[model samples]
Target chain A: LAKTTQPISMDSYEGQEVNITCSHNNIATNDYITWYQQFPSQGPRFIIQGYKTKVTNEVASLFIPADRKSSTLSLPRVSLSDTAVYYCLVGVPFSSGSARQLTFGSGTQLTVLP
Target chain B: DAGVTQSPTHLIKTRGQQVTLRCSPKSGHDTVSWYQQALGQGPQFIFQYYEEEERQRGNFPDRFSGHQFPNYSSELNVNALLLGDSALYLCASSGGTSGSSEQYFGPGTRLTVT
Candidate 1:
């Protein structure tokens, strides 16, 4: 499992773009970078995932540099409702008996202020 | 379309007691994973079950055990629980063993040990 590091908190205004960066210096070749958004009293929701380079979805985008040591989650045009904690995980897909649990770190709390 | 569901949205237990938490996976998911989240902290993996078998487990002690049913519903059991066991227990489900697959989470079971 690759250890991940992310900011403890971030503040963003409504309609502004927010970027949260996560560092996983020990990322493996087979590991994938994934991001999840969690609201209070709700489960973490999958936002975006990528192996390398950039991947975009309707909700967010993921950018991974060539080193694979770090990745960024970009949320565009944020709203107050988008205020939540975001988690970044780095792990290889389950293979054989490997469980590769989603080891969550203290996530980046993005406060979307008005 | 019903997402993962967990029972007893909140539970209170005493030290040295035992508790059981339940989870029903999404409509088509076959794997169920459990996690524990403390206040101001990220979730910690407990274990994962598939096909009625324990496929993978985390660093948690044996006191934290789980079982999966043929219907893909699961239970997390804690024996001789301690005060430290108090936390939000989360249940997540995915399609299979693939680590890259997205996991859907349920409203966690907030366990308060008194």
Candidate 2:
């Protein structure tokens, strides 16, 4: 399993764009970068996932470089409801014979100010 | 379709006691994983169950065990609880046998050990 390091906290204003970056210096080739957002008292929600280059979705965008050592999660037009802890995980996806466990770091706390 | 459902949204236990938390996977999901999340920290994987068997486990002690049923529902059992064991327990489910599938998390069960 690869360990991830991300910012402890970040601040953004409403309607502003937020980009949280994660560094996994020892990421494996079979590992994929996935991001999750967790609000207080709720489970972590999947944001975006990518192996390399970029992947976009309705909620967020994931950017990975050629080296695959780092990835970024981009959230557009932040709002108060978007305030949460964002986790960056690197792991093999779950499969029939492969029971890969998702390792979550302390995560970056993003607070959206009014 | 229901994403994931957990029973007893909250629980309170005493030291040396036993407790069981239940979870029902999302429709069509066959894999269920458990996690422990402490306050101000990210979730840590406990174990994953598929095919009614334990497939993978984290660094947790043997006191932490789990079981999966034929319907894909699961139960997490903890015996001889400790104060440090008090945290939010999360259940996630994923479908298919492909590596592209992502796990969906439930609301989580808050457990307090005194």
Candidate 3:
């Protein structure tokens, strides 16, 4: 499993764009980068995932450089409700008779101020 | 479609006692995985179940075990629990090919061991 390092916490204002970066220097070739957002008392929600380059979705964008050692999760026009803990995970996809499990990092706590 | 659901949103147990937590996967998902989330830390994989068998397990002790029913629902059983077992137990489900599949999570059961 690849160990990921990210900021403990961050603060951002409503309407601002937020970017949380995760470093996984030991990422494997088959590992995929995934981001999840977790709010208090709720389960973590998938935000975005990517293997390389940039992948954008309605909720967020994931930017993975060629080296795959690090990835950035970008949230656009953040709102107060966007305040949550964001986890970065690196893992291989599951295959027949194989359990590809995801290992979560401590995560980056983002506080969106009104 | 309903998302993954867990039972007894909260639970309290004592050391040496046994506890069981249940999970219903999201509609259309057939694989289930369990995790333990300690305070101030990230979620740790406990084990994963597929095809009614234990497909993979984490580094947790045998005290932590689980069963997956034919319906795809699962149960996590902790025997002779300890105070350190007090944490949020999360259940995640996914379907499709293993290598690049996305997982969906439930709200999780908060277990407090005394």
Worst 10 residues of 3 chain A by lDDT: A93-102
The residue pairs that clash in candidate 2, if any, are none
lDDT of 1 at B95: 72
Tell me how candidate 3 scores on lDDT.
Answer: 0.90
lDDT of 2: 0.92
Tell me which of candidates 2 and 3 scores higher on TM-score: 2
Best by lDDT: 2
CAPRI quality level assigned to candidate 3 from its DockQ score: medium
lDDT of 1 by residue, A56-103 (tens): 999888999999999999999999999999999998754323455888
- Residue B92, model 2: lDDT of 93
Candidate 2's residue-wise lDDT over B7-106, tens digit each?
A: 8999999999999999998888889999999999999999999999999899999999999999999999999999999999999998754344688899
Residue B35 in model 3: lDDT: 92
Model 1 per-residue lDDT tens digits across residues B1-114:
688899999999999999999999988778889999988888999998877888888889999888989898999999998999999999998875444378889999999889
- Once superposed on the true structure, which residue ranges of model 3 sit more than 4 Å away at CA? A95-97, B96-100
Fnat per candidate, as a fraction, reads: 0.58, 0.71, 0.55
| Lowest-sum lDDT 10-residue window in model 1 chain A | A92-101
Ranking by TM-score: 2, 3, 1
